[model samples]
Target: MTDLCVEVERAPRAALVRLEGDLDKVSAPAFRKCLAGLAEEGCVEVVVDTAGLAFCDSSGLWVLVEHQRTLSGMGGTLQLTGVHGVLRRVLEVTGLRPLFASQL
Candidate 1:
């Protein structure tokens, strides 16, 4: 089980979150908490850097989608960067690749 690590850099209304390791059932809670904190801090623009992300599961995807919708509804945005390998394929297969703004 790869533990997920989340690091955030905040700036005004924007934030950048760096994710590493596996984002699965066990680690999703931590990731969710991190995002929730950012939202509560009034971060309107979020950029998730998945360059160090090793693996991601359905639960992880759900979290991402949930936050994306929440941010969009609040007139905010959530984008992803450094997407590649299996994660990229998963997004593509699910037709969710287009849902996020890719900064790569």
Candidate 2:
């Protein structure tokens, strides 16, 4: 797994988290940390840019889902951007695409 890097940028109405490297089990904790920070910041809208993600596992998916739940509980939302390859298939196979606002 590549060393995961997450960079957060603020937008006018949403916060964007740019993901770099693999988003699999080995690095999912870091992703969770980033997401938690955003939650703590009282973000009402979030965009997770996965354009540079090399890989992701079920654990990663769970973490993201949890983040979405967190946002939803707070009357917020989470958006997914630039998903591709296996990650895209995972979302389809698991029928989780409809749960998120995805950027094709």
Candidate 3:
């Protein structure tokens, strides 16, 4: 299995996290840590680009849900883009689609 890799580019208003490979139990902590670091840096808006993400298990989804809650509490937002295939179906099936902004 390909190891999960998260590439982050911080902008003045938002942080873009491009995810690649599988986001599962082993890699969820890394993903959470990246988001936490961004939050500590006063990043309010986060855009997760999932174009290259190959897989996402429940643990990964849990991290994302928690992150969204955290960002929302800080008066920020988490948006997702390039979600398709299994990831898209997962969101839809889990009724988590409405949690993220629809645009992009």
Candidate 4:
């Protein structure tokens, strides 16, 4: 199994969550908690940096989708950067690309 790591950096206007390793079922809970923490902190703008994301399963995709929906409902935004390889294809194929602003 691929190890997962999440690094968060908060800025004045937004928070950057850098994801590394595999984001599968085992790690989705951590990702969700991170998002929940951001929400509780009243963060309105979030940018997820996928520079080190090695793999993302369907569960990971679900987390992203749910967070994006939640943020949009609150008039916030979720931006994705460094999306490539299998993860990129998954987003495109799943038609979830429109849910986030991609900086690839």
Q: In lDDT terms, which candidate is top?
A: 1
Candidate-wise lDDT, in order: 0.91, 0.86, 0.90, 0.89
All candidates in order of lDDT, best leading: 1, 3, 4, 2
Better of 1 and 4 by TM-score: 1
By TM-score, the better pick of 1 and 3 is 1
State in Å the error of residue 30, model 4. 0.9
Highest-TM-score candidate: 1
Q: Model 3 off-target regions past 4 Å?
A: none
Candidate 4 residue pairs that clash:
none
Candidate 1 vs 2: which has more TM-score: 1
Superposed on all Cα atoms, the candidates' RMSDs to the truth, in angstroms, are 0.9, 1.3, 1.1, 1.0
- Pick the winner on TM-score between candidates 2 and 4: 4
Off by over 4 Å in 2: none
TM-score of each: 0.96, 0.93, 0.95, 0.94
User: Per-residue lDDT of 49-99 in model 3, one digit per residue for the tens?
Assistant: 989999989998899899999999999999999998787998999899999
Pairs in steric clash, model 1: none
Residue 20, candidate 2: C-alpha displacement in angstroms = 1.3
Report the Cα lDDT for candidate 2: 0.86
